[model samples]
Target: MGDELTEETGHEARAPAEGEADRRPGRRALLVGGAAAALGTVLLAREELSHLWWRLPGVDHAREDGAVDYRGAQWIAASSANLRRADRPDDYRIDRVVVHVTQGSYRSAVNVFQDSSHRAAAHYVVRRDGHVAQMIRELDVAFHAGNRQYNERSVGIEHEGFVEKASSFTDAMYASSARLTAAICARYGMPVDRTHVIGHAEVPGADHTDPGRHWDWDRYMKLVRRARTALA
Candidate 1:
């Protein structure tokens, strides 16, 4: 009769405090299991983690031009070899725009920026077709200007083609580059005049004259002012 009662109840007729069994893991075991699982996940996702790095507060990886403007231009981040990180508006004040002429095709310029050996790049590159590519973020300094002071306090824009080729400075290039410059000026509180917006030739100790005589300052400034108004 007692055996029949035990079979029906699934337990012996005894005090649970004295006879109960504890099969569950303790707190230390649970913590160890969780840590092991987390480690496994990290190891499994190493390939994905390797492709990403810490970017500045304003960096937009989804952007093709790497800027928030979302104009037709896209962003392609330059390698670390061509740029260095800096806290903009806090550590450095970008008060000027330095224009340059790439002498080579836009593709060639991008290739050079990607190469560690070249050790040079700009914040933005305006192509002959008026398409823009932002290689470096505005918050960081690009190795564009020959002078350290100019590089530290200015945003460098490279126009596709050589200083000697007046034909490369197309109407579309002027308008697009002007719009970009206006946007930069607006963001940085810089004036769109020639004093604040200058050529690579204007830099102190600069040996090269790019965006030289062929670059129409009056037309570019007019376009820049108009673009800034439109953007506002």
Candidate 2:
């Protein structure tokens, strides 16, 4: 009887151990599955947040003529001063469209514009990915050109292209800049000719050379013409 009782106790212990071993894989699988699910949720949330932050306003809908309103596009404001005039001229009379290339990243460009110590700014900064950032209002004079006289009459647009020969301006950036230039010209009654659209290098005694040699001026001009035609 003693031997039989001992054998029964051993069987009971072995049964529980076998059962626990069988459940181990399922428990581990559940833990791994839960971790995977959590990671996916986190990634999805991050994507949604990024979309919300970068999405531009008034560019999604189509008009009656099937044309979208690009002029109403808003950008992240980075200006430190309210240099804009409360009462602007009824007829927008911009004389020149000045093109530049930020020698840094889009974030860095905005930071420099915002930083008082830098004492540098531009009206607009166009990203390589085709994102537009407004540092100053159109009516306000941005401290872009060292010459205050030129700054007063010019609309400065800084493109995202590195000074290195390896870095090239993307198609999206060219397209976006053309569209932006067209909108500005239309609003301000500025001509789309080369005389009106000048590069930073062309500015007299400008002392800055940007939108470097890698930028395709011919392709950019073609897009600009297309945009002008569209506006017309």
Best by lDDT: 1
Across residues 129-149, which tens digit of lDDT does each residue of candidate 2 receive? 888876666755667876765
Q: Which stretches of candidate 2 lie over 4 Å from their true place?
A: 1-72, 81-92
Question: Which pairs of residues collide in candidate 1?
Answer: 64-74, 64-75, 65-74, 65-75, 66-75
Model 1 spans with C-alpha error above 4 angstroms:
1-70
- lDDT for residue 65 in candidate 1, whole number 0-100: 38
Displacement of the residue 231 alpha carbon in candidate 1, Å: 2.1
Error of 1 at 39 (Å): 50
Q: Candidates' TM-scores?
A: 0.70, 0.63
Per-residue lDDT of candidate 1, residues 1-232 (tens digit): 5443454667665533656676557799999999999999998688434423334455423333346343666888788898877656555688999999999999999889989888889988999889999888776778899898789788889999988978989998999999999988899888779999999998999998898898898999999999999988
